[model samples]
Target: MTARERQRWAVLGVAAITASIVATRSLVVTDRDRVDRFVDAVSGEVTPGRIDAAMRYLDPDRQPVEITAYEATEAYGPGEREALRQRVRERLRAAAGMRFRVLRKSVTMGARSASVSMQLYSSEGAPSAEYVLRKHGDDWLVETARLR
Candidate 1:
């Protein structure tokens, strides 16, 4: 091929690769933001005593489930849901001296819902906590937590 033609092809190839990279990066950032927003909502609920606002993210019919630090490896169920929520609130009140904050978050989106994993920081500046969230419609709710 002519030198000019070869150079043109190389430029086009580079442009295509750059575009793909940009698109992929954009998607990753968008996913990250979604998780952040969801975590923020949860934090707001806990901080402001807005349990109703937090419930907006939960599947009303699904019920809350609790998994303690000892049972962190197990799945949560309705039987322990309410007790767990109360325990979390008490712990935050006592240990953190404040409500939770989302330190980092990751999310995966589905057709109409999403799931998030979040690292949460306490008010007392202790090690971060882990929370798993599931989106219900447009809102996100905590499905489980692993406290530190």
Candidate 2:
């Protein structure tokens, strides 16, 4: 083969590899966005009276989990989780008439599981907390949460 032909093939191979890398990165970003949307829907749009909406994002078989805050750790069951959601709604309503804003979200996908880190701001416009979400099958549930 001619040197020019070999050079052309090398260039084409490099271009193809770069394109594949870009496409794969785009897919990862898209999946992360999906997790972000779910977090946004829970923290931004959900309210006290509409706390049930948050359940859609949680795994159906989600168990009670412990959330460690600055100086305390609280274990929450399904009912307590609902109550916490309501309290969040009420606090949001009393503070700003809306839910908190999600500052950032990072999602990592694994072979059979995934983890998400979400930074949430309080309705009072202060740093509220960071929640770690775990994905089981198609559902994402809060596994641990801590205040920033």
Candidate 3:
């Protein structure tokens, strides 16, 4: 090919690579942003409906471990999970409007899965704790939730 034609091709190739990177970056959700969404979905409201809504973010096939130090792991079906949540619904509702004080948050992308870790305040008090999440398709599913 002519020198001018080769140069034009090189420029086109560089433009294509740069465009690809920008597109991929836009699709990537930062660790902090994902954790913030999790906190908001879980702690924003404390009602039966809201609790169920939060649980929807969990993976039904895998055990979605949720504990508050006082309670035990919750890994049940839709009905059973709601029943278990009912046990703590009353107290949690009292702590509504809970705001999370994020201490640390991170996400690790893997070959076929990704994990999210975050430390934040519990509704009960200021005790910060870390939680785990797993990527299911394009959305992150809660693998474990530790909140009061």
Candidate 4:
């Protein structure tokens, strides 16, 4: 082969190897990691004025979200997504300066679903919650959030 041809082949080989490495790195994100990332995003989005942004993490299909407080519980399903959103908005407005964080977390991952149990901390109180996530296409969506 000519010198120019050899140089071009070497460049192409390097490019191919680089692409392979990138793809492999992307594929190495395990289910647990995906759940953590999703949760982290949810945590960051739950601000006093970002109710809509926070709700976006919820499944588009309107999976149920169970909220428990003061020994009372309510389940918000497809027909009650708006009510759920309204409730969240009210809480966010009420706790304007409170910070929300996950103090501890445990993850159980299935092939297409995962459960994350998290101890949450906020100015109001420390509560434990379980979040269920389902794989939809290439993304993970919050199927349910049970707050205690």
Best by lDDT: 4
Per-model RMSD to reference: 7.9, 6.2, 5.3, 3.8
What TM-score goes with each of the models?
Answer: 0.46, 0.51, 0.51, 0.68
Model 3, residue 45: displacement in angstroms? 7.3
In model 4, which range of ten residues has the least summed lDDT?
44-53
Candidate 2 runs further than 4 Å off = 1-34, 58-61, 77-96
lDDT of each: 0.57, 0.62, 0.61, 0.72
- Which candidate's TM-score is highest? 4
lDDT (tens digit, per residue) of candidate 2 on 4-105? 999999999999999999989876644456566666566774454345555555432475555665777766676575666554455445544456667776
Candidate 4 per-residue lDDT over residues 1-148, each given as its tens digit:
9999999999999999999999999879777776777677555335644555456666444455566654767677676766777777776676665666888888888898888888888777887877787787666777667767
Which residue pairs come into collision in candidate 1?
A: none
Q: Which lDDT value does model 2 have at 101? A: 69
lDDT of 3: 0.61
Instruction: Give each model's clash number.
Output: 0, 0, 0, 0
- The order by descending lDDT is 4, 2, 3, 1
lDDT of each residue in 1-148, candidate 3, tens digit only: 9999999999999999999999999998875566567666664445566666665666445545455544555454444555555655655666666665566656566544445555666555654444566665556666565543
Question: What's the C-alpha lDDT at position 117 in model 2?
Answer: 64
